[model samples]
Target chain A: MKKISTPYHHGNLRQALLEIAVKLIRERGADALTIREVARRAGVTHTAPYRHFKDKASLLAAVAREGFEMMVKETKDQFSRTTQDALARLKVCGIAYIEFAIHNPARYRVMFGTGRPHGKNSALRKASEASFGLLLECIKECQKEGTVRPGEPMEMALAAWSIVHGFSMLFIDNQIREKGLFAADRESMMDVVVDHLYAGFKPN
Target chain B: MKKISTPYHHGNLRQALLEIAVKLIRERGADALTIREVARRAGVTHTAPYRHFKDKASLLAAVAREGFEMMVKETKDQFSRTTQDALARLKVCGIAYIEFAIHNPARYRVMFGTGRPHGKNSALRKASEASFGLLLECIKECQKEGTVRPGEPMEMALAAWSIVHGFSMLFIDNQIREKGLFAADRESMMDVVVDHLYAGFKPN
Candidate 1:
């Protein structure tokens, strides 16, 4: 395979380092990542990464931020392909969230795993908030259509998020596989899970 | 502080090593664990841990098994204290699960984290199944009492597990804290989250 190389310009170098870091995380595990290793993989001088990342944690935060952005885009794309019915759109978005994690298990782990940067203004935190904002918007739409029960939108959003996030974590962590649950038809199992969640949102 | 030391007898050594392993994971992280380190911490010879555990992974499996056993006990204790109303008992058990994770975050992480042993007869796997069995029993009782909607018990149980597990992961992983989603009172927030799940299980 031909080695992928990036030009040494400041902008290209930073983006190149981030790309290499993600690739390394995917190929190996997050523990395999390092500035020197990413720089080597990017075919840049060892010190080149220093200009872009202050430390390993900072690099990880960047990777997590990228993961969040990709998740938001994928979920929105999936939701957009569905009908205008808020409930249907919510279901599409929820499944998309799980699919994103299942397809990109390593990135998903880093996105939610411990040790990434955390603060009000941190890049990763902001990216996560943006992704969650998409879910909140979907819930609001459901409420507007009188499909979902009216309540504090944040609480409802968190309830929706917990179920999907929990399912994804169990799937990614192999808990679902280990227990021999949903082995034959995962898509159907997802429908059952989503349907249960949708039932909770209906006005009682 | 007095260091807790164990006798070097073969039987005591194995149990001692497991306890020390849990302690090390709590203080540092799972990656910090090793047979040699656990043995040293247990005040045993370097080769002693090898007698019980063939490798680090095996040691981790033992730790995870212990975590599951403790979780089962904790959930059962909590359930026994609640009224016979299946729904009420289920709520108590669910809260116990989250409380167990919060109080023993490292052990909880190891219990569900990737790369541990997984097989039909593996000790860790059996322990996990047993823990999940308790939840299934609660759901069954709910169905018998005509509280929860009648359906496939397994599906309802999985749905319930997903929500609580997701909430615990989010709380433990600091996702809730980072997003500033629930700052004032987490206990009440948990009630809201669990209430949404309970609503789903009600008959239409």
Candidate 2:
């Protein structure tokens, strides 16, 4: 392997490596991706990336954190649109979440489902909380407006979140097959899952 | 690397490799696993596995199918101890499923979370269905006994499966954080998750 020395200018090598790393990971499963391959693909010396990331795990964390930051941004963008009521905002948020997963399945999966230990990454942790915080606020709004059933606000948020997140996972994984796959009825099924959560929380 | 062309006279190289693969994957993340690594670890020639599996994907499929079979067996075993009531049986199965995950988080993650397709392996697909079939049957029993709400059996099953499976995923992923680093009151949380599912499906 010919080693190309690092360029005189860093010229965004860290971001460049992160981009290539994710692309390689998305095309091939993580098992097949490595820092050497990423460096090779990025036209940098293998050691060049080491300065930015001590190891592959650090690079993975960087990618995951970036993905999470984007998730927070996605939520904020959805919340920017005005809705007549809390229930409507809740629905849009749900749609937005699923849409985000569908668009960036691999990145989103790596962000949440990769089973990596991210406890050390405070910014990443805060980013995840920020997204969930939006959901919590919406749930509170729905509860106050009498559209959502009253419960511990956190409980309501977690429960509703489990439904939407679980559904999104199932949909992305295509786990719903042999009867769960309805005809072009994505919105209908989303409504049903959301409504199930709604029914459980509805003012009784 | 010296190629040990000596093939085993008896016993199962494939099975041996799989057993090693599972434990190694669990201890370290899946990214480090490889056919050559398994081969070297198992003391078999690199070519020895080719006789058993066409490639890494086939070996992984074998591993996944084994995981699903284990899932089915454990679920059935859980239901065998107690009186056979639909809801009760289902709850036990859920517990068993979570136990399998906690006990075998790596295998469980690969079983469902891996993005690689399980491919055109009928046995693998059938085993996956067989594992899920146990849940569907229990849900039907609930309906028959008038405990389950009126709805499509599969839809209900999907909901219940999502709730428990999602809970299990969160638990297995160790994503649930307890305040103050206290031991998580997982039993209470799991109970509530299932309780919500049961409540959502009670006959109106």
Compare the candidates by lDDT and give the number of the best one.
1
Q: What are the interface RMSDs of all the models? A: 2.1, 2.5
Query: Candidate 2 on A55-156: residue-level lDDT in tens?
Result: 877888788788867876877777777547888888777777777776776777777566765677776677677777888898899989988777667656
Candidate 1 per-residue lDDT over residues A68-184, each given as its tens digit: 999999888877687579888888878988889889888887787643236643777888889889889989998999999999888888888999988888877778877778554
User: lDDT, candidate 2, residue A14?
Assistant: 85
Best by TM-score: 1
Name the candidate that leads on DockQ.
1
Off by over 4 Å in 1: A1-6, A9-14, A28-40, A43-51, A115-117, B1-6, B9-11, B32-40, B43-48, B115-121
Pairs clashing within candidate 1: none
On a 0 to 1 DockQ scale, where is model 2? 0.32
DockQ class, candidate 2: acceptable
TM-score of chain A of 1: 0.89
Worst 10 residues of 1 chain A by lDDT: A2-11
Evaluate residue A76 in candidate 1 and report its C-alpha lDDT on the 0 to 100 scale.
Answer: 81
Stretches off by above 4 angstroms in model 2 are A1-10, A177-184, B1-10, B178-184
